[model samples]
Each structure stands twice: as structure tokens, then as C-alpha cells.
Target: MATPKHDLPDDDIEYVSKTEMKREMTALQQLGEKLIPLDKKQLATLKLPERLFDAILAAKKITANGATARQKQFIGKLMRDVDPEPINELLNKLAGLSDRHSAWLHRLERLREGMLADPKIVENFVNEHPSVEIQQLRQLVRNALKERELQKPAKAFRELFKLIKQYIPEPALPGLEASGPEEEDEE
Candidate 1:
């Protein structure tokens, strides 16, 4: 083999080896991942029809008014080209959850009133309802107690029920206790 000399003025030389090619391949793969376009299925996942779409569109209109023509186009294409079934399902689930949460909140509001009327219960609530901000809970408690005070007949009925339950629990059951195992274990 002839030993190549530097005097042979060649402008290009092979510097890229298998290791460098592999490194380049990995870097290109990462870049390709970042550049990959969202498929129709992935796009459809965000076009939530009910509450989520309403929320997103409201926000989009507010923020996107300042965006350029290309940005607007991109957003419009994204919204239209995507599959929306997942979004609809998610929104339905969220709406259901919201309804359940609201029912719980109403129950909590009723409980808050009961607690406010009873100082002991109020103290217990103040300690237990950690998620309810202290100031907000205090205000709600005040309102509930005031409303309860305004309902004289209801208050009286509740008090009477409490008293009745406290005193009228003397009924006896003939056989309420468990009768142990029914048969001996085979294994």
C-alpha cells in the first residue's frame, strides 16, 4: 500500500466513521421525532365537543386573536383534522364528575349549616375541612347558620328528631348475632 502524503492536495477526506454515523443517526432520529406531524387520530383526540371544546374555543378565541395568519391557519387545521371522540368522552366524564362534585358541595353546604348552628360541630369542621379555605368556610358557616336561624319550624323539627332518635332506640332483635362458620373447611 502506498502511504498517502499531505503534499497530495486533496480538498475532501473521509472523516465520518461508523461510530460518528451511528451518533448522527441517533441525533437525526430525535430531530425527526420532534418534527413528526400529529396523525388524524391524535388530532381528533382534542376536538372535545361539549364542555371541553367550549372551554378551549373560548380560550383560543381570546388568545389567538393576536396570533398571525399562519398561526390561525395552523390552529384551524389542527382543530378540524383531529379525531374528537376521545375529547367528547373525556368531556362527558368531566361533566359527570362536575355534577357529582356539585352534589357533594351542596351536601357540604348543608352540613356546614348544621355545623355552624352547633359550636362543637363548627369547631370540628374548622379543624377537618382543610380543603375549604378557612376564610371561605367561615363566611359559608356564617351564612348557613343565619339561614338556619331564620327557619324556626325546620330547626324545631330537626331538634325533635334528634331527641326522638336519642330516646326511642330501645327495640330488641331476637337474633342479630353472627352464627359462626356454616361448615368445616375441607382444604
Candidate 2:
């Protein structure tokens, strides 16, 4: 059996090789495909080059699978010409924000569960979040607990989750806060 030739010295071999380069390009192509599903506004947030951005928009308009695949390949080629590091970084940040949002939601679920399990937890939550509507929250919790005991439809339970979510402060998506209510008022 023949051994593969090393293009760089043994120490430098740890760096990127031809196989790695191909893998990176494939990954970039996959990322481009992922971007295609995003709306135009979301794509604009990525700060992509005008040509690449135009290609992505054009790609989104294609209905044929074969043409879309070809357009994705073209986007990958364009990705190679631009600096992918910043693009990857921004993607990672967005992913991290999504993870944090999920975690925050989970925390709210746990809090709701804890409140249902112990009456004291309700007092504690009310104390911590004084701005919360105490009477409404207590009513929702009582109704949810009663529904659980009776095995009725979980309407109250769902409402409790909605109320809990309202209390939890969520981080806004990038580029959205700027154009929110304040911008509308200015116009």
C-alpha cells in the first residue's frame, strides 16, 4: 500500500491540507444553503458582499432543484473569495443567542413547576419580581394546579406558561431593536 504524500513538514502537517480545504468548502456550501431559507431582511443582517448577496437572492427565486443546487455551488465559490471568518463568527453569535434563549425558556418552565409544587415558591417569585401582577399570577397558578388534579384540558397550564414567558426578559435579535417602536415614532 502506498502512503499519502505530506505537502508540508511533519509539524506543519497539523495545518490545513487539501482534504481539509475541500471539507471547509463543503461546509461553506452547506452554510450557503442554510442561508437560502432565511428571509431577505435576515440575509441583509449577515453583511454579505453585494454580489454574493445578489446571488443568494437570485438563488432563492429559483424553483428548480437542479438550478438551486448550481446556484448554491456558485455561492460557495463566492464565499471563498470573501473572508469567511467574520461570517462564521456572526453565525456563531446568532447560534449562541438561540441557545441562551432556549435556556431562559427552560428556566421559566422550571420556575413554573417549582411554584406549582410549593406555595412558598410563589411568594418568593412575587418578592423577586414585584412588577408582576400578583393576583393574576396566583389565580393562574391555582387554576393550573386544579386542572392538573382534575385531569381536565390544560388550558390554565398553557396560560401559566404564557404568563411566565411574559415575566422573563428576552434578548432581542440583532438589527431588530433599532427599527422597532422608536423608529416608527420618528416616522
Per-candidate TM-scores read 0.27, 0.64
Q: Per-residue lDDT tens digits of candidate 1, residues 64-105?
A: 545533443344444443343343333333344434334543
Q: What are the Cα lDDT values of the candidates?
A: 0.41, 0.74
**lDDT of prediction 2:** 0.74
lDDT over C-alpha atoms for residue 157 of model 1: 34
lDDT of 2 by residue, 1-187 (tens): 9999878778855567899999989988887776777667666666778999999899989999899889999998888876665455445545654564466667878888988999998999889889989999999999999999999998877778777766666554443331111111000
Q: How many clashing residue pairs, candidate 2? A: 0
**For every candidate, C-alpha RMSD to the true structure in Å:** 22.7, 8.3
| Weakest lDDT window of 10 consecutive positions for candidate 2 | 178-187
Instruction: Evaluate model 1: give its TM-score.
Output: 0.27
